[model samples]
Target chain A: MTRAFNFSAGPAALPAEVLQQAAEEMLDWHGAGMGVMEMSHRGREFMSILAQAQADLRELLAVPDNYRILFMQGGALAENAIIPMNLLGQRPDERRTADYVVTGAWSVKSQKEARRYCDVNIAASTEADKFTRLPAQAEWRLSKDPAYVHVCTNETIHGVEYFWTPDLAAAGLPDVPLVADVSSHILSRPLDVSRFGVIYGGAQKNIGPSGLTLVIVRDDLLDRSLPVCPTAFHWKTVAENDSMYNTPPTYAIYIAGLVFQWLKRRGGLAAMEAQNKAKAELLYGYLDNSGFYRTAVAKDCRSRMNVPFFLHDETLNDVFLAGARERGLLQLKGHKSVGGMRASIYNAMPLEGVTALVDYLREFERSHG
Target chain B: MTRAFNFSAGPAALPAEVLQQAAEEMLDWHGAGMGVMEMSHRGREFMSILAQAQADLRELLAVPDNYRILFMQGGALAENAIIPMNLLGQRPDERRTADYVVTGAWSVKSQKEARRYCDVNIAASTEADKFTRLPAQAEWRLSKDPAYVHVCTNETIHGVEYFWTPDLAAAGLPDVPLVADVSSHILSRPLDVSRFGVIYGGAQKNIGPSGLTLVIVRDDLLDRSLPVCPTAFHWKTVAENDSMYNTPPTYAIYIAGLVFQWLKRRGGLAAMEAQNKAKAELLYGYLDNSGFYRTAVAKDCRSRMNVPFFLHDETLNDVFLAGARERGLLQLKGHKSVGGMRASIYNAMPLEGVTALVDYLREFERSHG
Candidate 1:
């Protein structure tokens, strides 16, 4: 199974093993005479696949009994609107508000989409600092009894992360729940599911394919949907029906279930967390020491999943990208808004991939300098 | 590439050519060094896939230039609520009203879901007739200046269809637009896109896989969405972004695009319609003469896509199903809501598959009677 290291952000690299298993089962899944794609979602074959996926994910995350796991569609971008529609605006219509802590591009989007559904309060924002760090919890000005506090735990574009969920107890609002968009780094480490009211991530990164959006929410959050919420996006309905209120992206969920199995086979999330940390350290260590490459995020909050680095000589960016592609390291180019190079070493990226990248970084610096 | 014929209602069979092509490109799509699943939706590789899928669909359906084709998620079930959110309640606040014509199980679902978002006017209903046929268009009691009129052009479970789009003028509401859920019978026959304001269906039936939902809407309908509509379900935003408003079911779109190409290779919708008609006639022709089997729907309104038949002696049902399964003619079981057996011969089911089913039906009848 010869394969290249893919580094595209979101719809990024997948475990080679998972892809192989899917290919093998493309025509017939377990002698069911039809592939998972062709099987009815209501049929027993697919129901088994869906049930196993949910159970495996819950076990892996140590999800609390009260949290309902929803396999939704529309990615994290759509969730920017869906999240607010389902969980926010608890009070009478116009009077309800949701507080947002803007860390980077994603959180900024979360707050913007939320504005369509309810009043939005910017509790804190790091845009002034070019999103290199998270806003301190103390500096935040939260609304009294706001619907929920939103945070993007990992900023894919800016390469910043929040190491902890917000502690509103210090702000004298211990009852307020935290909502996080953990799209980029959800399964890269072990997370405390009970700590947050909602934990959502698009499956493209650190999960499985792009169409599937995973939502783990406290049961109570489901019933707070506004009167106007799309019934399909209503968390209570989704959780009650086990995400089968719609078709539920069956193939995407099947792939994600394979990923969960892969994670378990590799000693679960704890092992994956260590491997992710080691891979991140290898790349970050080289960038820190190199005179030709530099990183922008604060040292403490620098994302362990997405390491966005810039070359000192930006003129040679294309040449560097071409070279990386030639060596079978693909999609190393950063986002258009933040141009340079971003090596999104997600869970599927092995330590050897990081080593290959580190070695290339050293060679490129010496030759160009 | 040996494969069995799959007759599932939805998440149904795909073209053999499409599945083979998908398998071949699973690891590296045209040397992009990543599968279509791993490619970014905004990247050139997947963008071409999306653009081609839309263009081919437009050609296949002969869609007008003014229609915006949206590749969305959430299936036809989600469209139940999404349709109301986007089209109903055009008048601001306090929720507007919509008109619904209930012919069968699916139309019942459409109206029930719409009640959550708007006032629903039952223009007409054939449920009193056990969903056996479509009510006469002249009898429909459409609402005055309704936001939009809803219909299930083909009821998958009830095995009934509307060969022609509803004429609002007959209902004395000529200005009202018609919205149709054409999920089961979309590509099985030739259709005129200009007749309806919106034509939507889940991909699994005739398009490709489960996750993708195709929405063909008139450009003018884009801006009528309610303030409560989820932005992702907002037709204007979806049309504006060309369905990239969310990370669409990329792989599903890719597979569907391949199916469209395959359809074109087989001489397009005109050819598909002829084949589907022949397949339906073969099964129906046998049932008509057998006397051992029966079909209850009015012959004029019987769906060419999903044909459900019943055995005269209910006790032979298990034996009939077992015999069909033994011959590899699978998933003939009807919807749970309907007690009889159903055979959904979509575009992917070749005439030879229907011939086998016909031959098996004859043999099973002879052996049992």
Candidate 2:
């Protein structure tokens, strides 16, 4: 494999070993006499593969016995609408208010979709601060007897992350459950499952591929679907059937199962968290010391998975990208809404890739500054 | 590649040539220096690929000028919910209602999901007869001033099909438009575009892969999405953005585009329909002539793609499946609910595959009858 780093936000770089294994198995998976793509989803071979994947993922995350893991389709964006549809039935129809803490673009989108299904109150927002940082949980306006409180734990665009799941019970929100979008940083760290009601993410970033969504939802929240909620997307039906209510995204699920196996082989989430932490620190240390560049997000809230930073001199933007590309660093361009550079070092990214990027950054700054 | 016949029901066989081409281009697509999966969705390379696929599909189906083609995710199951969320806004909130004609499994599913968004009236049904035949269009009790009328043109499980679209206007009913689930039989034949307001299919069966969904919708139905519809799935937004509101199943789209190109090279839909007809005739003729086997669906309403049949004695099911598997005819097992054999002869299955199946059927009947 070439020594290139791909840093696109989602649909980002995959593990080199995983891609190699996928390529090797593309034509025939383990002498099954058919490619994984060609296997019948209901056949014994695929069913075994699906089962092992769910089991491995459960072990890796240390998921609580109370929660059910579901393999779903339509990605995380669809889940924004689906979550509210399934959970808003918790309260009496007239008292179905859901609270949201908007930290960035993804949370804003979540709140907008939630408004369609229930009464929504924005408990906290960072939009007024240009989404440079997540607001402290103490400065909030939470709704009483709300069905659920929603938060995007990792904001993909603005690069802010919640390092810890806030304790809702201690904060006078004991009755209200918390839901989080951990799309960008799901596998980068170990999570506390008992603290949250639902944890969901699109699989494209750290899991395996696009089109598959990973939802870790409590069984208690499974049955309260709105009368108008689509049955296929209703958590109750999906959880009951083990996510086989409809034909799941079979191939994507197969690939994701492979990813779970790979994660387990690499010593599970704890090992991954250590690697991710070291990589983030190395890259952030260089950026902190470099007078030529600066990160916009507050240091405490900055995402370890996504590092968005701007060069002090805007004129060096094209030159910076060109130099980076020449050195085999790819897809480092930041989102268009926030024009700068971004390096999304997800779970698949090796620490060596981060060191290489840091070395390049230091050399470039020395020459330009 | 091995010369095996694949009869998988959905996640079914693809053309051998298509798989070969994909393998060859796995690392780099059209000398673009990146795999199709790795390319940005908004990049020029993938954009051209997407546009060509859409244009060729439009041309092959003789799609009306007013219809917009959308490439979406979440399969036919998601479309069950998406269709209503996008279309139910056509009527006043208090007056919105949709009419459904439930011929089989897929129609029942669509109607069930549509109830989440609109008041549904069952226009026609074949449940009393165990879904063995299509309901006659004349007997449909269609609602006046309904938002839309929906039907599953082909039922994959029941193996029943509507050979023709119902002409609602000519039947003296209000001119409510038609929406059809053409998933199982989409490219198997030519369709009259003007007869339906919306036509959609999941790509896994006859198109290409599992993740991509195709929706051909009339232009007039573009703008009236309900307030609750998620922007990502709202047809109007996807249609306006040309299906790029979210990161699509890019590699799936590329493979589907390749399938469309292959279909065109083999002389378009007319030629395809003839080949499909021959294949279906060969299999059905053998089943009909052999007293040992029987197809339950009415002869006139049998699906050309999915042919579900049963052994007369019911004791030979295991022996039949074993013999078929030994001959490299894979995934011939029927749906669990049907407890028989289903041979899905989609567009990719060659005439020779059907001949082999027929030959095997004849030999088995001679030995066992």
Candidate 3:
């Protein structure tokens, strides 16, 4: 079967090896007599799968003993409200406000959703620049005693990313925690888990599939949830139950486990980072050289995972997309908010796929120019 | 590959045909060149899949046009809080109370979760009876001005099913909506959708897989969500966005769509109900006749989907489960809360599987009795 190089953002591509393994084990998982989806969450067979997945993830990210990784649901969107519900109570006597660095569309949504639970202070915002760049940490305004600082390390829609982590201690908010929404670019490289109090992302982009949300939080932060937080979404409750407080997305987690295995075989995140860098450079280099296409985001902060670009001749946009589709380069259409083409080369996207995309880009430019 | 007869409680058995089709389409779906899990939630292919699944479900249950079916996540346990968060505000100015008929473990949990949102009145409870029978409608003492009335129509852990729907209109609470968590027995029989304002279930049992929660709420009930409800969990927002407010569990929905097709091919719920009854009768009939094995739940209210039983000598529980596994009967271990054995013969469990289970039961009884 011919599989296309899918470039859709979030719910994007997964490793061929992972899908192949899943297909083979669909009916009988390790001779367990049933597929992973059919097994009871409490059963020994599924418990093993869950344990392996959690262990592999911890090893891959080098998550410290102080952290608890939660396999949650409702995606990153749901986590927007959940984050505030869990964190706002940390200093209830204080004004119950959190600092937000609004870099792009996702961070904007994040801050807005948090308003439902607590007061939000836009500590820094680059929206004035059309979300084309990340705000410099030096320019961020300090909140006297905010609950936590929130940021979207990677903006899938706006195609901007933070290459460096914010150091709250250096900024004089030593005790204040830093929360990041790393949905699009998680697992692309090694991360200092100690730097952030909480890191969360939707599994669809770089992990496995939609519906399964991964939340990695410092163990100490788990107890700060407000009374209004749903018991199922409570971080402490989920951690205490080992993510089976309710039946987790079993098949999604299993698929994610298969992906973790695939990543490990490929030499983990360091190797994946190298390959991702090469793929991003290959496409970006071609775009930089070609006069026919141009990316709007600032060069230094452009997302290595999601690259949104516009045709030099805006009128040729439809023709460019139609041609890209013909050559098996799919989902080249950009987000409606940003009227241009976007190619999200996530962790699962091989360099060969990016090469094909560059090849198609050159051909389309040569003909259309 | 020899397939076993799996009887898991919630993340239970699925139709073999659906699993086979899913395996075949793992890498590429309908020549789209990417699996369903890999497709964009907004893409034409996945949207068609989402539309068809919703349509098929609407047809299968004869859901009225006023009812909007929502594909959510976090399972029934999460819905426990989400329900009150969305419904408690229906009559905000009033005493802010909701009535609950706690017949079993699930409904008791539901009431406890709701207490976090508003005052919860135990309208009727059979917890005193060990949840072996449904509390009669005549005995219900619902609140005069409740925001809503809640019930667990089928309790998976208790093995009790509500064969009859509770009529709030007949109970002098016409405007107060009746909400039911029909997680385990949702598709096992024909449901009168018009009777309930909200009907929700986790999909793992009879629909497709874990991680997907189905919510069928009448249109009038959507706008009653409290301001504190997470927007992602708001029924109104979800209905307006057609359950696409966030990236949904695409693969799970695709599998559910396949099951819906399988259900339609097998002559819908009516035919499924007949087969389920016959299968339940075969196993329950055997347990009733044999002194060696006895079911704890009342015959009239015993779940056709989940049949919980016990050996006269409780010490043989391990021996019974071991023998059942050796003979390809799986997941017969009952929940720890009510230990013994539970054979969950969901819609996917064929009569032959139940027959095999009965044959094993007879053999075990004769050899040990």
Candidate 4:
């Protein structure tokens, strides 16, 4: 049977080709007599895989020479706490204050976890707007001499996106660094790495799987961990050891590496950005035109990766889901916290999958509305 | 195609039955329309998978009601630092000392990493004896009021096993709890859960795969994490959330759950213990009898799973490995840290796989010894 278009907000759909390649290589990776999962993490085979993955990702994002990429574990949730522990000590006088722009649930979580290790300042919040929009940079009440400014560039839950990177330097916070959690929309577009101090995400979305996390931090931000920080999690230690200070989520890393290779073969992040934009546009265009579908987020702020739209008649949710299943579209149910349908069109999602989903949506609207 | 008998130290061989089932379920888990890797961790289908795995594991290990089973990420190496961070607050007023038994490389790593969190006391060490034996309990220089006495009960590299749990109460350390890193030999035999405060292991060796870790912790040890502990790594937070505090390594956990169910179907840990004994006996008996092969660990302390053997003539190491590979016995190469071959026959290794390896060993000896 052909695989369905899985739109889970993640542990979500991987590219069918990538999954097929993985299945084929499950037993032997390139005639090495061992699966990528079975190879030693330090072995030449895995090393080459790791190196290529880093290079490809860096190339795709145009990550600068001043930045170091670390493949870590425990997802972005873990990094929320890890980031503070590593950076809070950059100022020696006290636990430095870190500013957060709370756009949605993910940023809220990052802010809360950061409070355990640093003095967190909520510079701006979309909570009053129910996390449906990004706060304008002018509204942010950032701290003086903050360790870093944090933002969730794309809010997975609220389906909100920051179309452009926030400019801290232009906002008179030139000395402070900006950290972004781009978990859901990380690889869907090209990024200007020099504009941010740190960018991290869980691989469950566009990368590969749940066990791997990707962290890109500027080299200048290295080695400022508080004494209380666990050595395994210390950015300096992890960076120096080349993410091998601990046994990494080796298999997840290998799979993500394969995905990076896949992305490159498909003509890099620029091509992916175009494809993702097209898929999102096709789905949202249908939703916008239909009287039966209503999207919650402001049109300008709507996420290009995760588009959450509700049926005008909420009772039609069951019928909509059933129709979707019959058409081999899956995980279309939105987060229970927000009742609606969400289509996550990550880089892995082809235009055909979105087209199939859009066709089903229109047919369902014709019948139900 | 048949798989070779892989003897990798870790990211090691899995039960063939488990792999077969995993492959069969790779596309859809019990008709759920998603592979374990692709499912949202919070979905009901994956929840049932997670719950059954935890429950089955609890029953198999005879874990008491007071203990919490945490399925975590990052392997045992990360636990080295996480453990101390979580446990050192046990005695609030005193600067708690965590005693360590350094039998080999794993314990030495544990000790070094623990220093990052608390004062470490080397209660006992067999490194002076070249890690060929476990030090006697009487020989330990126990620190009074230690937070815990830590030991790597089975050293994978040294091929040393503690046949008996240390009687710390009788050794004048009654109040101190025991923590064991049972990564290599956790399920090979029955364990007294009442004796250990905490036990953790990376799943790749005897469990399922590389990304998942199994941590069993006693009730009394749950609440004392240092304030500086990363909330995600804190045992209490992880236990309270039932390992769903974050997106888990869903695929690895599902695979591990399958292995647990498979173990239950085969009469649980007791049957596994018996089979492991027979397999170890067959391999060790041949090694003891063959003058060409020699095992350095004391016979009484020999590991039932990992058997490291040296050839009398070291020059034929390459030839021995090449011959073994030719006969479909693969990864017989020894760790670079410890020269000579090591055969890791975990619970996944059947009697036949061991016999095949032994047969290859004999043939290679005849040709090159």
* Top TM-score hit: 3
Greater-DockQ candidate between 2 and 3: 3
- Evaluating just chain A, the predictions reach TM-scores of 0.98, 0.97, 0.99, 0.97
Any residue pairs clashing in model 3, and if so which? Answer: none
Which lDDT tens digits does candidate 3 get at residues B45-119? 999999999999999999999999999998999999999888867565457899999988899899999988999
Best by DockQ: 3
Q: Give stretches of model 3 more than 4 Å off.
A: none
Q: Candidate 2 — which pairs collide?
A: none
Report per-candidate DockQ.
Answer: 0.60, 0.45, 0.84, 0.53
lDDT of 2 by residue, B95-118 (tens): 789899998888988998888888
lDDT by residue (B1-369, candidate 4, tens digit) is 357677777877776677767766777677776677888888788899999998899899999998899998878888987888888765664576799999999999999988877789999898888899888887989888788899999998889998899878997878677999999998787899889889999888888778788899988888888777778888889988889888899888887888898889888888999999999999999999999999899999999988899999999899888788787777777777888998988887789989998888788778777
Q: Model 3, range A1-369, lDDT digits (tens) per residue?
A: 389999999799999999999999999999999999999999999999999999999999999999999999999999999999998766664589999999889999999999998888999999889999888889999798889999999999999999999999999999999999999999999999999999999999999999999999999999898899999999999999999999999999999999998889999999999999999999999999888899889989999999999997989888888888888899989999998999999989999999999989888888878
Lowest lDDT block of 10, candidate 4 chain A: A33-42
Question: For residue B68, what is the lDDT in candidate 4?
Answer: 90
Q: Flag regions of model 4 displaced more than 4 Å.
A: A93-95, B172-175
Model 4, position B40, has a per-residue lDDT of 84
Ranking by lDDT: 3, 1, 4, 2
User: iRMSD per model?
Assistant: 2.3, 2.6, 1.0, 2.1
What local lDDT does model 1 show for residue B349? 93
Docking class of 2: acceptable
Give model 3's TM-score for chain A to 2 decimal places: 0.99
